[model samples]
Target chain A: MSDHKFTRRIFLSGAVVTVTALSLTGCTEPKTQLVKIEQAGAFFNPDDLTLLNDIAEIMIPRTGTPGAADAQVAAVIDAMMMTWANGATRDLFSNTLQKIELMAETLKGKPYSSLTLKQRQSLISEIDVRAFSDEVPDYAEGYKRLKDLIFRVFYSSEAANADYVPIPGQYRGNLTLDEYESLTEAYSYGG
Target chain B: MADEFDVIVVGSGVTGGWAAKEFCEKGFKTLVLERGRHLDHPDPEYTDMLAPWEAENAGLMPESFEDAGRYSMLRKKGRLYKSQWARFFVDDKEYPYSFPKDRPFMWTRGYQLGGRSITWGRQSYRWSAKDFEANAKDGNGVPWPIGYDDLAPWYDYVEAFAGISGAKDDVETLPNGDFLKPWEMSCAEQFVSDNLKKNRPDRPMVIGRCANLSEVRPIHTELGRGPCQARNMCKQGCSFGAYFCSLSSTLPAAERTGNLTIVTDAIVTSVLYDDKKGRATGVSVVDRKTKCLRKYKAKVVFLCASALGSVQVMLNSRSDARPKGIANSSGLLGCYIMDHFGGAGATGVVPGFEDRYSFGRRPTGIYMPSFRHEKADDVDFVRGYGYQGGGSTRPRTSHTGKKVGIGAAVKEHVGKALPWRMRLIMYGEMLPYIDNRASLHPVKTDDWGMPLLHIDAYGRDNEKKMLVQAAKDAEDILIAGGCINVKSSHVNPENHIELGSRTHEMGGACMGSDPKNSVLNKWCQAHDVPNLFVTDGASMSSCSTQNPSLTYMALTARATDHAAKLLKEGVL
Candidate 1:
């Protein structure tokens, strides 16, 4: 598949696709939908999809709510990389994933896909901490971009967030936190 | 033989809709011509109901499409081009206008049946008395033929029909209209407004008066219009008919009268004037798709094709009787170009609103009315500006702020909302300058063989100075109102501001008391051609900081009333 331009049909349901096999021990069952990863498109291979799926789950692991993987964040990112993102954004996303693989090899002496669940969690946690610190690393900015996209897509999805109301009938300017939280669904506006 | 009607309204926008409605209701056969393709009410193209994830690329256009030169003007504004609503804007490559290489003017346009009203920022306000008298007092332009009093009842007339929602705030400069119940401000906004009232009472921040229906009335519901759902996605076109647009409100009302006829893809090239009768005979039109030339005869014509659009038509209508253009007796048909200049603002975090959140989107925010009614030592400009912005609770996620947290902790953090961040963007009045003008390009022509409009206008020293003061004042006001990390942004040092970027282009065919200096008189009737009227933004004497569409509607209502009366009396 080319890095740019995937007709909606080819991107959504066509091409060699697989549901991410989250077989890691102690991993929670994906309560929402499974992420459909294409074989290759905009800098992702089959192995890279596995690594990304694991990373997304570790970042927003299911508790009482659905996690990033559950929300099909990886699938959305793949589509965005091909269609929505520019060359710069695609490059950053690719570079960030490559850096994660290099770090796994450097620290754990193995590929990120081959690492144990505990090892993957510890390494990603360390990277996340270092990404936001004062002494910025080379991988910091790119990693943040990837992480931001994951969180953005996950939160915006109906699978992850139940508060996405399409048409809010009224506007109340100062609803108290207690009153807001008591509602089944929350209200929001603007980007 | 040409298609005959009592009235021909060119451009089915805000003003055109009002013009058609009034004339049709008054028992006149009105024909409305639109240059763009027809779009029905509750247009299927509206993406308002789509959720973020459901929308294409999550409400983002492809980077390649956005980078195209056609949307370069849209990129400067930064909101429309990147969003799903980008389709509403014209592709500049297809319908082009030019300006000086050094002086760029962003003429943001939406040329469908509803025109730019589909994508208009619906903050409607009536221009104050101070606004009318400022031009004459400051000697920037000619005196306004009509004042606030002349347009007051007309404002009431339009507001009652349009269903404006606003507070009757006692700010004389920003007059209150006959309104529906007002939208409320957020906790942080109220806190800042209350603080400002204590500190600077003269500059009290009040709820923005807007066209969104807070409560649907009989007048609105009679035409299938409903109350605003507060989606805040009005630019995508409201299927609810909640917020006002020509397709939703006025055109439907006009259609109900059975005296209205609409023809889309009919581009009016020029007004056809009769030398012997000394009046406009009809209009020359070209089919947008087929390039088929045609004529339409009418007893009267109202040019509501925006400021630049109407002026371009008049400037192209050259003849032996009036070679300067149709209503060129004043020789000011395409002069005195103006738009509200705004590239200044302040934004900061409101410290104590974390415990409060708003439900749904209010279509508009609070406005700080212009305080500089007259000259002062502190004020460096002849006219003033207003702020149209509000506070919103910032979204919290794993990557918010300095930290990009991981694991279950990140999800919990994302669940809670962050403190409110308030933004205040200032839009200042642009003084009418005869030097800042638009004319037909001698060499260039569009596919339809109409001359491309050549605009030569930019923000001046006065506008730049106003922005500087506006930024400083915004920072000061926010800091005094307990906002943290206040930062101000102003115009670029090299290029002060983009004139037409705000989409408030006004004063190309200005109204004035003296027939020698203006194209249109008080009734928006052309001085040379009594049967022709230019009632859109082109007829504006001055560009006020307040949104101009409301005034355009009021003027159209008022002008058509006069035209229908004259027609009845056999004055033509």
Candidate 2:
């Protein structure tokens, strides 16, 4: 089994340590670190990063192959939010996190952080079905969007395939219908 | 003192990059001017590594940016911020143009050193001999000043460096290029191509000739680029110079020569003409960063600033000798704008073949070369259209709105994902009509104060007719290949080019044999100004259905060599 732990500490130590430190320091020290802050604005917070990982794990939890969380989709999401997303999007992300937390409190009578893995998994499954069926009207759309983002990030990510998905080596231009069908199916299912 | 060079190539785009490389290689001091900010090649910015989910709006275009209307054209085309890599490509405040109420011109573009070449669909195909002679043979637009023979060698040269990966299709309508090893087709695509070839022999489908290097040749390896690792993340800009964009290929070569000097954030306002010498002496520019005016002199000038952009510059270059414009002696400087009519084709699903899978993401599709104006045996339209499309298995999105969360249901759904056979798209050719021209608007200017191009181009009757027929043909072929749920979509005949959809926008300052009918002479040199050349798509007399960058590169190389020889022999 692959270690799918995507802790904030690990992320901070890896690609974004300097950016994270600069941003945190900038908030404390005002005038001198303005430029650094402006540049560091293109970095995500540790909590949001962890939330992204949790969301990916919830969306595409590991089965036979490596799942979204294992790919460090949270880190990928964090990088994208900082660099590409605009203001309203950041607000939406915050709202989504808040909503997820609220849902956990309502369902399990505890914060998502305090829930065990099994409890967390149960809550995620319940929320997903409710969102899919349009039973939870308030959080449905946001949850769906979040689910799609997680899947898209994972499916298109390098970590989604691992050894499970069959990546075609050479193109063969004269295959039978059956041969083509099998190949396309493997591609869709991530092998 | 104002910096003087042997040549000043405006716009480091497809043609400009080629001109810079050729001139620099020829040992001429060349300065490439770009209005956008300078972006270094290879690892210019690290944003390319980002994934779509990482995006704030989940790769959606920001409402604020859309409201500003700066990238209205780009946004309309569905190219949203999947990553930070695409953010720098558009400025949401400046660069505005308006189309007529009913006519929506999606002028999708990027203005970095490499221009839109970074985001371009690198589908490279050589124009057939028939395409070169079409204008004259059919009495459409002006006849091409030069033909396939003139461009053949340059095509070979550019192909060698660009590293096009494709199979040699001996179809006369779509000539084969000097190619590297072709990328493998998806199994579905292979089935379709074989079936289409057998069932419809007239339409021969082959792998799309693209600039993505499947195998790194010595020339490409020298440029610090490696072979494509089959990562389909091309539109975001390849970090590996595995593809041929100006940033990846030509501009880098020019940089190595040391004679190349690139001045970004400087927009060329107008070409300064010397009436006595009958040539362009220099160019006046507006610094985009500071709004300051600057002038740069050169012995020769190459207007490689895209199709409409070059035409705008030429039309703005008015002198006392020619009050209309510098190269408007023929009154055809800013006329006959043409873009290939895209988005007409059929898509369907193929059943079975659930076991065999493939590896690596192929960035391109199978190409069905044009069969329409081959022998001219009872063809309705004068010109022809070609097919560029591919196959893919239906992804999880196909089950969108059908399934719910990430559980057993999702797993079962993913396991049983349907095999979507292929989608065939026919990019039809639009003939050049005299009325479909671009000119200066009465009262509008870009950020640099140059008059905006009032483009009034649209596909004519013949083009519309061709698209309709091509759509029908696409449907028939898909149906014959055992594709289910085959459906055809007709391209909107009006504004089908979508202003800048193809980005192969051609013909404003067109090339022709007669100076009375065309702006540029046979060598792509301006008829009025011998030293000034427009070697971009503006030099194209007619629009062929194929992607135009390869042709533009070939023309630029030929023109560059011609200009160098002329300069060396004191012809200039």
Sequence-dependent TM-score of model 2: 0.82
lDDT of prediction 1? 0.83
In the range B412-469, model 2's lDDT, one tens digit per residue, is: 4564445656788877778888777787777988777877777777766777777777
Q: Interface RMSD for every prediction, one decimal?
A: 4.3, 7.1
TM-score for chain B in model 2: 0.95
| DockQ scores for all predicted structures | 0.40, 0.15
Model 2 residue runs over 4 Å out of place are: A1-147, A150-191, B46-63, B79-81, B374-380, B392-406, B415-417, B491-497
Question: Cα lDDT for residue A131, model 2?
Answer: 78
TM-score versus the correct structure, for each prediction: 0.89, 0.82
Model 1 per-residue lDDT tens digits across residues A56-150: 87888878887776676666677677767878888887788889999999988987756667788889999998888897999999888788777
- The interface RMSD for candidate 2 is 7.1
In order, what lDDT does every prediction score? 0.83, 0.73
Candidate 1 off by > 4 Å: A1-45, A58-60, A85-108, A121-148, A183-191, B320-323, B348-354, B392-411, B479-486
In model 1, what are the clashing residue pairs, if there are any?
A: none
Q: Please provide, for model 1 over B145-170, each residue's C-alpha lDDT reduced to its tens digit, 9 standing for 90 to 100.
A: 99999999999999999999999997
